[model samples]
Each structure stands twice: as C-alpha cells, then as structure tokens.
Target: MSTIVALSTPPGSGALSVVRLSGTNALKILKRLTSTLDFTPRTATLTKLHHPDSNDLIDEVIVTFFEAPHSLTGEDVVEISCHGSPSVVRQVIDASRNLGATLAGPGEFSLRALSNGKMNLAQAEAIRDLIAARTETAAKQAARQATGELSKRLAEFKTRLLDVIVVLESAVEFVEDDLPPTQTNQIKEWLLFVLSGVGALAESYQSGHLLRDGIQVAITGKPNVGKSSLFNSLMERDRAIVTAVPGTTRDTLSETIDVGGIPVVLTDTAGLRQTTDDVESLGIERAYRALNEADVVLLVVDGSVNADWHEAGLNSFDHKTQVVVNKIDLVQYGHSDLPQGILVSAKTGEGLDDLRAAILGAFRGSAIQADGLLVTNARHHEHLQQAKIEIKEALVALDEHRSEEMILAPLHNALRYLGEITGETTTEAILSQIFATFCIGK
Candidate 1:
C-alpha cells in the first residue's frame, strides 16, 4: 500500500501537535523533507524540516521513526511533532502529500494494524471505545478489552468447542470399527459448559451497554416542586433557570453528570401541570415525552404539600421511577398522608447523598466487579445471542440421538458466530461498518 499521513492530534492550536505516517515509503517521504540522512529507529530526533523542492524551512520539528514489523501498523512509520499552529500542520500535510503520501481515511491506521494481524477486531473496537469513553469505569473497561481480555476469553471458548467437535467427529467416523464410542451424556455435558460460558458473556451486555452509553434520568413533577433546584443541586451549578415564578422553565434543560463512575444525563423537564398558555403546553408535552423515554425517573414532589396523585399521575409509575420529596428543610415535622420518598432539601443540600446513591442504585442495580470482561458492543451482543441459539439447538439434536450430520450444522454455525466476535469469520461489510465509526487519525 502507498504511504498514508494524518494529524494524530486534535485540531487547533496547542503546545504541540503530532502528524503520523505509516506504510511502505513512510521513512522515504520523511527523508525527502529533512536534511538528516540517518535517524536511529525508535529514537526521537530534533531536526529541521524543509520543503522538498524549494528547500524552504517549514519548521523545526521532532521526528520519530519505527521500522516495519515492529510499529503500530506493523509497517515502517514516521511521526512529526511540530508546533501547534494550524498553518504549520497544514504545510507539513501538503508537503507529505506532494511527496506521494495520501491522507488517511477514518481509522485507516488502526485498520492497517488490524489487517496486519497486530490486533483483532475486538481490540480495534476497544481502542475506539477507549478514545470515546465518557467515564473512568468505561475507560477502564475499554482499556482492558483493548489489551486482549475479551480475546483471551473467546480463545478459550473456541479451544473447548473445537475439542468437543473433534471428539464428536471421531465418534461419527469410527462407529463401524471397534473404536470405543464417546458417550452422548459426556458430549452433552461439554456442550452445556460452552453454552453457559457464552450465556454469561452475552448477559454482561446489560451493564456493558449501560456504562458505554449513559442512562437518561428525567426529573418530573408539577410546577414549583423544586425540579430545577434539584437539577442544579445535583449538577452543582445553576444550569436550569430557577425563580419563584411558576413555569419559569418553559423547556427542558439537560446535562450529564458522573454518578459514582456511571454517567447519568440529568434532564430537568418543565413541571407537569395544567396550563392554557401555548408555550407552557408545549413545554409540558416535551416533559411528558422525556419522562416516557427516560431510563430512570426522579418524581420530585413538594414535601410541604399533601399527595396530589390525581394530578401527578402516580398510578402510571413504573419500576424505573423513584420518588424524591424536596424542601424537607421546611417540612421537618410530622406528615399526615404524604407520598413516600427520599426526603431532601435542595436548598440546604440535605439528603442529596441519598439521592445520588439512589440514582446510582436505580441504574446499575448491582456493582460490576472491577477488571471483569464486559461485552459492550451491540453487534457483539447480537452475534453472541445467535451463537447461544445455535448451541442450544445442537444440544437438542444431541439429546434426540440425531445423526452427526444433523448436529454438525448448528455446531458449525455456533463456531462461526463466535468467530465473528473476534473477526475470525467477520465479513468485509461488517468490518467497514465497525471501523467507520472511528475518528480519522486513529
């Protein structure tokens, strides 16, 4: 392949920027631009870069070289660290292009690494996930996957499945001879072990996806019930418009906050109440929609007032809903028939800890153990589910004493589905789809 070049750092001015090149003539292109003839591989050299034709000084830059079969792409690579000025970055790119290097497409570098067998498809996807990770937990999970945690588990699964297939094939082939037959019960047991392993991996997608894409939490209640105040208190900033006037928030305001290492998008929707005004009606409509789509709902209510179930529509509450009674500072005394909820005052920051804990509990359900394998990708989840179905079908066929030919089909399919997870059996279309989501420089 021809050499490829791209800015490996984020756009705009900073202390410095990185421009990377990888392919067959990466070093050759670098040689044409700089005066230095010899560069020690894997060492950073401060050198002067000049235009190839004019020999005009481009910029004083630091260049690093990586030889083929040892670099990120498993090919010769060159990286230029230059001043952060956009003009300097542009000039360097144009010079490299003139020297026969093409601009890299999105994720081309990582794709090349994958194509060269430096990393599997799952590890490549994990790199993208790590770059896009929004929380510390998500980053850690992605980092672990990138370093081959999922690959190791899948490799073990393949090994055990292959063993089972080999023994079954031997049984089918040697039935006419005096060779000892493998018991059907033993085969069933082996298949069950593989099934249970895949099932556990597939089930992990729940928390995996939740951590990858954060949950939406909507605060819903009638006017003047401290929805905006609670939203501000949770965020530690006056994000929403708070005032004594009813219906001050004529629209929904949303912000993302870290709740115990899990990202929670807290949305303060307009108060739910009767309003004839056009704008307020529209706001209320949006609030209802937000509540309907929320993964978790914080139903804020006034602790000083009696239950207004008739107007608030408490009967429609689902399991994802949690009651939070605000303004407990004013209603610290006994309550006659108030709605049951976690009491707190957004004003004095009372019971806010409980509210945060409740939010985390509502979404996570139970804590995921540190450094465990998590299947976060939706495509991976689908493939795993398909594999599970095929394995179970194979198990059924074995129980019925069906012919070996009948069982092999599902077994093969199960193997194929598992292979797709690590890209051993993935199609070009799926590969393109997976890598297309990555940024250009990756």
Candidate 2:
C-alpha cells in the first residue's frame, strides 16, 4: 500500500494540530522532511520540517515515530504536531504529500489497523462511534467497545459455538444411532445456551443504538398545555417561548438533553389543533411530522383545566407515548376528569424528576444492563440475526433426528456469521462500508 498522510486533528487554528503519516514508507518521508536526528522508535523528537524539494522551512514541529508492527496500523507511522494555523498544517501535509505520501481517505488509518490485525472490526467501528458520541455515557460505551470489550464477549460466544460445531461434526462422522443420548442432550443444551447469548446480545442493540444515536421526542398537545414549559424544564433552559396566548409556539424547536444516561432530543412542537393562520398551520403540519417521526411522544395536558381527553388528542395511547399532566400547582385543590398520565407542575418544577424518570424508563426499560457488553452497530446486529437463524435451523434438524449432513450446513453457517462479527469472515465491501464512516486520519 502507498504511504498515506492527513490532518489528524480538527481543521482550523488551535493550540496544536496533528498530521499523521502511515505506511511502509512513513518513516522515510518523515526523515526526508526533518533534520538529521536520531529518530528513535516510540519517541517524540522536536525537529524542524522542511520541504523535500524546495527545502523551504515549513514549521517547527514535534515528530513522533512508531516502528512497524508496534504502531497504530502495525506499520511504520509518524505524527507531526505543528501549530494549528491552517497554513502551517497544510504546508506540513503538502510537504509529506510532495515527498510521496498520498492524502489518506476517510478512516484509512483505522482501516490499515484492521487490515494488519492490530484491531478487529468491532474495535474499528467503535473508534468511529467514540468520535461521534454526543453524551458522556455514549462516549463510555463506545470506549468500552473500542477497547475490545464487545470483541471479548463475542469471542466467548464464538468459542461455545465452535465447541457445539465440533460435537455435531463428530456426531456426523459417526452414525446417528452410534451417538450417545447424553451427547445429544449436551448438544441441545449448548445450542440453547449459545442461542440465548446471541439473542440477548442482539436485543441489546436497541438500547445501545439509542444511547449512541439518541431518541427524538416530540412534545405535542392542545394550545396552552405548557408543552413549551415542559420542553424548557427538560432542557433546564428557557429555549422555547412561553406565553398565555394560544399558538405561541408557531414552529417546532428542539434541543438535546441527557436523561438518565440516554440522549433525548426534546422537540417542542406547535399546538395540535385546527388553525386559520397560515403560519400556524404550517407549524402544525411540522408538529404532526415531528410527532410521526419521533421515537417517543410527550403528550402534555393542562392539569388545571377540565378538558376532554379527546379534544386534547390524548384519547389513544401507544407504548411510545407518555402522558404528562402539567400545572399541578394550579390544580392542587381539584382533580381533573382525566385521571391518567404522570402529573406534574411545569411552573414549580414539581414532578420534573418523575417526568425525567418516566421518559428514560419508557425508552430504556432495562434494554442495556450496567457494565454489560452491547452490540450497537447495525451490521453486527444483522450478522447476529443470521447466526441465530442458522442455530435455530440446526436445532430443528437435530429435533427431527435428521442426518448429520443436515445439521452441519447450518452449524457451519452459524460459525461463518459469528466470524463476520469478529472480522474473521468479513468481505472487503462490508469492511469498506464500515470504515468509510470514519473521519480521515482516524
């Protein structure tokens, strides 16, 4: 592969910027640009970088060298830390490029790392996730996967599966009648155990993905139902305008907040009702759109007013909808006809904790266990589904007392699908798709 170079840090001026180079020729290019010095392995050396051909001074930079098989990509690599000035970073990169280092495509460094066996595909994807993580919990989850926590768990599952395959293959080699009853039961037990593990891991994807990518929640109700106030309460900031007049919020406003370790994008939508104003109608249309698109809906109602539940659009409820009765302070002495939903006072912040808990509880629901490994990537979920299907097929074959050949095919397929998760049986196309989501220079 050709030598690659790219800015490792965010573009634009800052205190410092990193330009990374990796490949067999990485060290040679670094040597060509810097003054002659002992470029010891795994050491950061302060040096002056010059243009290879022009010999023009580019910048005073710190050069760190990682020798082959010990570096990020398991190949020789060099990182040039220069002043974050755009021109300085560009010159440094152009200098390397002029010296035969090609500009790296997005995620080439991590791709090389996977290609060289330095990290598995799960870890590589985790690197991307970690970079894109929005909340502290998301970052921690991604960091865990990046450090091979998911890989380790998947590896254990794969080992058990391979064990099952070995037993079944042995049975296939021998006649079915010759196989012991105890061994057959053991095979069934192992198959069930492996299936349970895979199913659990697959099930974790919902929470993992929600935590990583977050959920969109639309706050919708009739005019003057305190939807905007609840939005502000959830955000802990006055982001949306609140007024006594109905249809005050003419458009949808959104802000993201961390609720019980899950990122929630709370959208304050215009009141859901028939309107004559064109602008309000447009906003109402958008509100319905947001309502339809949201992962969860916060159906707000006025606790102080005796309004029909149907009139407020809260008659029907779904699993994704949570009813919030706001203005509890005004209704402390009286009870509204609609007795359902969580009661709260968006004015005094009463019941806010319960509201937050309700939002988190509705979506989270023990989908992710504390300190447990989760498979967040869609690709991994798909592969695990495939493996589960194959395991079920093998189990069916076993139950039917079919020939060993019938069971072997599904067992081998199960192994193949499992191997794809750890990148032992992945194709180049899938790898490309996964890595392409990464930023250049990793």
- What lDDT does the true structure give each of the candidates? 0.88, 0.86
Minimal lDDT window, size 10, model 2? 363-372
Model 2: what TM-score? 0.89
> Which residues of candidate 2, in runs, are more than 4 Å off?
53-56, 167-177, 241-250, 273-278, 304-309, 312-319, 330-339, 364-368
Give the C-alpha miss distance for residue 390 in model 1, angstroms.
Answer: 1.5
Displacement of residue 105 (Cα, Å) in model 1 is 1.9
| Candidate 1: stretches off by over 4 Å | 175-185, 274-285, 306-310, 313-319, 335-337, 363-371
Indicate the worst ten consecutive residues by lDDT in candidate 1.
363-372
C-alpha RMSD of each candidate structure in angstroms: 2.6, 2.9
TM-score of each: 0.91, 0.89
How many pairs collide in each candidate, listed in order? 0, 0
Q: Global lDDT for candidate 1?
A: 0.88
